[model samples]
Target: MTGVEHEPANERYAYSRTALARLALSDELRELADRAAAGVPTTNDMWAQPGEVVGDALDLVHQAQEALVRAVIYERQKHTSWEAIGEQLNMKRQSAHEKYRDAVAEWQLALQEPHYPAPSGAPVRGLRLHEAAYAPTTAGARLDAWVHEHIPAQRETEHPVTGHLPALSTAEEMVQVLDALNHLYGDSRTPPDPKARARVIERKAALLDRIAVEQGRPEAAQQAEEARALAAQLHAEAAQAPD
Candidate 1:
């Protein structure tokens, strides 16, 4: 009889049962199997075609078995007995030893092959003991307090031109930018003078124009153009106002 004709009905049923059991076990596996079986005339026909889906699956299985064998061989060469390795792999001691005897010899030969010096590099500098003070811990808090105690308070100086403006040496331009952002976003908590708001808007327009020209962003260019137009409109309205 031919191979198909000689095949037992019980063996075929067992194969079908196992395939169904695997499909039930995982939705992902079932989906993957479905995708592989799609467009095919018959699932059984895939086994007959040497370079088909079944062949690809068998190749993967062979690769996994070979990797496992190599791992077992490496472990055995490290003075690990076959029985100990078998227990770790959940296999019989005799089976493990028989399967990997040649592989173990190959691994032993590979280990004997040469050692070379790696390229040298600069040694890394670890963080200093005092630098640990920045960490978010009780020790860090105590260190910060200790440092603050040792530091002296900064003395304030009077400005020559405007005593009204504080001698804090703060970046006033940044403050103006922040004011403009707040005004544009309608954050009215910190109310600014009308004249100061107009000046800020003009300065912000100039800054945006400069940034737009340098960066080449269409959105920024559009914003800069709009700001300049608003500033010009505000200036014209201010000029037309009665003194």
Candidate 2:
């Protein structure tokens, strides 16, 4: 797993396809199948296992997602209306367009013709992997944060607020910020990025300030303000000093 880079693992999404598949549903998986056939309750321990139902359900969700991607491809190729897509997806036209706008654009730009040498079923995933790895644009990150927050709404689990990424950031800065994030979360053994120091300080100070205000922690708020001022000073100094 050391060499593998993938999505952030959350309750809603699995880390990787391989990892998910490797997770055996349960020894009772076959028994659960039998119980279902007999129209009996499957949750009983005799025919069930803890977490297995949810795990199997999530796997089906992953499968559904693959199919959904292909469907989007076909629909976009056919020049389907966003309203129709939205209705099918149980969302508004704007919501449907917003959700898949980037994807639609990417596919449209990539393919010169509809056929394009007989596209494979899962070609979109490869493009996605490249986008994730070298996401020089904030669009990817914004969409990612949005998806993460929105998907878990039904579960009532709050996600972290990823404040807007600086639009003025260069590709190099984006890379640095991404490296820092990956180091902090994606892997335990990796060290943080030196280039992300200023942004890291600023972002942490901003988050702390938000938390303090929300929790009515006056002392914490004061500390966060002081930290933000310090970060600003460092940023100014670095800007002036030049690299």
Model 1 C-alpha lDDT per residue in residues 66-87, reported as the tens digit of each score:
4466456445534578999889
Candidate 2 ranges beyond 4 A from true positions: 1-49, 109-243
Query: In candidate 2, what are the lDDT values of residues 109-205, reduced to their tens digit?
Result: 3321112232466343323222221222232344435446445752342322223222222333334334445544544676433334565566556
Q: How far does residue 143 in candidate 1 sit from its true spot (Å)?
A: 43
What TM-score quantifies how close candidate 2 is to the native fold? 0.28
Query: lDDT score of model 2?
Result: 0.46
TM-score of each: 0.25, 0.28
Q: How badly does each model clash, as a count of residue pairs? A: 0, 0
Candidate 1 residue pairs in backbone clash: none
Weakest 10 consecutive residues, lDDT, candidate 2? Answer: 18-27
